[model samples]
Target chain A: MIQLTDVTKQYPTKSGPRTILKGINLTIRKGEHVGILGRNGAGKSTLVRVIGGAEPPTTGTVEREMSVSWPLAFTGGFHAKLTGIDNLRFICRIYGVDFHDRLDFVKDFSELGAYLYEPLGVYSSGMRARLAFAISMTIDFDCYLIDEVMAVGDDSFREKCKVELFEKRADKAMLIVSHSHRYLKGTCNRFLLFRDGTIQEYDDFDEVYEKYKELLAEPQTF
Target chain B: MASNSLNSSSEGSFRQSLVVQGRVLHALLIREMLTRYGRNNLGFLWLFLEPMLFTLAVTALWTATRTIHGSDLPITAFAITGYASMLMWRNMPGRCINAIKGNTPLMFHRQVRPLDVYTSRILLEFGGSSASFVLLVMAFWAFDAVALPEDALQVVVGWLTLGWFGAGLAIVLGAVSEKSDLVDKLWPPFSYLLFPFSGAAFIVDSLPDKAREILLYLPMLNCVEFIREGYFGTKMHAHYDMPYVIVFNLVLTLLALGMVRMHVVEADYE
Candidate 1:
């Protein structure tokens, strides 16, 4: 279970402080897949980051009773100067898992045979994403947090991700933030629409999709 | 009944948090080593070699110049003891200042705190410099270039005090630099200014009475004096107050930890 109480996030800008989230209260129980949709600058990514414990809220509390993984396949967590295998070893050590045991699995899953030994700085975007996906999959978490970078690599790799995350871990809870409504419709059980620093939940995908379309069609007030 | 269960569970999680922090620190230490000193061309050997080279250059300069200040002691011994302690204390804050910004991605992990980042850098600085100091002393003694330290216990204690002081200062600087750009601009000039008063070049006993009294207020100066006393023994007089250094370190450590806690709370992730 993950719970957030009165969560607020603000960033200092050149023109005073910009408020991103305003007193958000949320709870996600086990086995619930949540999809978050938002237009540009609507704080979808910030909300997920706060939920994943990557960033602390400006004012509020987050209580996590389950292990929460970092945003899946996000390259920000890997050190570019280190090799893919070295980055894997570091993450494994911190997570208190045996790196040696998971090495073969990550190598086979990532499919970057000899590239794992090379520095991550040298790896192409696709290779880095593949390594990130494989490592996140190797580590078992009660809940996974994913940002918009889900559809990485070619068609085959996308299929692999869908099978690994959706088919294999069907029971695990997931919170995904994405602009692709079709992908969310296929994956998520519930929907959250972020607008004006607040969230509105929709139990039905078609209903939320209509509302989302209306929201997009509306002219910008500011 | 629900509250009771919540309290018990929270207590259990607290203990688990400590274990997670330990594991994260261990991982960070290994990552620091690998990234800092890669597997090619002398690798980890450079950790000790860097400091040894600095000390050797300074010692050679002092010997060649014959710049003795009313003291009959060997310039090599004087230079090594002073410069090694200087590097141990001075390099730490510089290394720590922008550490978090460089490893921003690592902060994504729930278990990796800002404190862990500073701790790993501090450990590397302290460990590398401390090892180099010990090795240099041994080498010099073997060559009959310097005498064995008079009191090994005092030397160890003094060295540890210096490390503790450096670690605490580094933590504070690391957190402060994260908040403001001014610290980045000011620290270099400030550190250079501090070098002279750090007691790296002269003994406290050689200073004028009024100058000695003021230098005593600087904890780093006391740390250097304590170390020199251990090295030179009764051959030279060293002025340092142990209790003052201890209290200074304790206060600075508490302040550093408090600053780090604030940084973690206020940290804005990208």
Candidate 2:
């Protein structure tokens, strides 16, 4: 289980302190799949980072009773200078898993084949995304926090992810942050909509997505 | 209770966190080694050799110049001890500053805190310089260019004192560098300015009483003097106050950890 109590995140700018997450109170029970819908610059990523324990909140507390995986994202985790294999090894090392155990699975899942020997800097964006997703899957966690979930890879890769995440790991809890209504409707059992640095929860997908669409069409306000 | 979430209640037992941190540090060390000295000529050999080569070059240049310090201490040993100490303290901060910029992605992992990143660099710096110092001294002894230290354990303690001071300074400066770009820019010239007064160039005993008083204010200079005293023993009169360096180091450690806790979590890469 993961619990966030009155969490707030702020970033300093030339103008002033920008409060991104004003007060977020949330809880994810065992094996619950939660999806968050938000437009750009709405602090969706910040909330996910806080829950994933990658970034600390400026105020309040987040408690995790079960192990949480790192924020699985398209970018901003892998060291580019290291080879794909080396990055995999590094992740395994830090997480206290044997790299040799996950080596085969990542090799087969990423499908970069020989490219895995080369530096991540040389891989194309698609290859990098595949590698990132594949590597994250190898680590076992009670809950997974995914950032920009629907944006990475292509149709086939998405299919692979669906099978690997939903079908294979069906018992695990997942918190996915994305703007795609269709994907969220299919994958998530509950929904959270981001507006004005706060989260509004909804159990029905259609109701939340309708509000999300309204938010997208709403006028700009700071 | 108000506490940083990274070290908060839900992160499991303290022992478990230490185990995780040890694993993270080992991963970071290997990763740093690969990125810094890739698969090329001599590869990671450059870790120790780079410092060793630097000391050798400085020693040769100093020998050629023939610095006469009134006392009859071997110039080779003086240069080696001095240069080695300087490199340990100097390189740590140099490498630590802006360390977040290059390794920002790694921070996405919850275990990879800013202090951990700085620590990995510090360890590398310490390891490299110490290996260089020991290897050069042994090689020189083999060739009969220098004698071994009179008190090996004392020499180790003095070296450790200087390293501790350097590590503390590096952590403080490294954390501060994240707040302002000026620290990164200012540190190089500042370190250079400190070299002439760093006990590398002259003996504390040889200096005039007034000059010695002023130079002793430099903690690094005092440490260098201590190390030399350990090496030369009764032959050279070395003046240093160990308590002073320890107190200064304690303060630096507090500032460093406090600053890292406050600001380092906010670090992000563009």
lDDT tens readout by residue for model 1, B15-102: 5767776788899998888888886758778766876687678778877887755366666677677778888788899888888877
Q: Rate the local accuracy (lDDT) of all candidates.
A: 0.83, 0.83
Candidate 1: how close is chain B to the reference, as a TM-score? 0.90
Model 1, position B169, has a per-residue lDDT of 88
Candidate 1 scores an iRMS of 5.6
In terms of DockQ, the best-performing candidate is: 1
Q: What digit string (tens of lDDT, one per residue) describes model 2 on residues B187-265?
A: 9999999988898878889899999899898899989988998899999989998899999999989988788877885
TM-score of each: 0.93, 0.91
Cα lDDT of candidate 2 equals: 0.83
Off by over 4 Å in 1: A218-222, B1-18, B265-270
* Residue range A1-222, candidate 1, lDDT tens digits: 888888999988888999999989889988899999878888898898888766789988778777777889988988888999999998888878888999998988899999999999999999999999999987888788988756688888888988999999989999998888889999999899988889999999999988888989988652
> Candidate 1, after superposition: displacement of residue A109 in Å?
0.8
Q: Once superposed on the true structure, which residue ranges of model 2 sit more than 4 Å away at CA? A: A73-75, B1-11, B101-104, B265-270
For model 1, name the residue pairs that clash: none
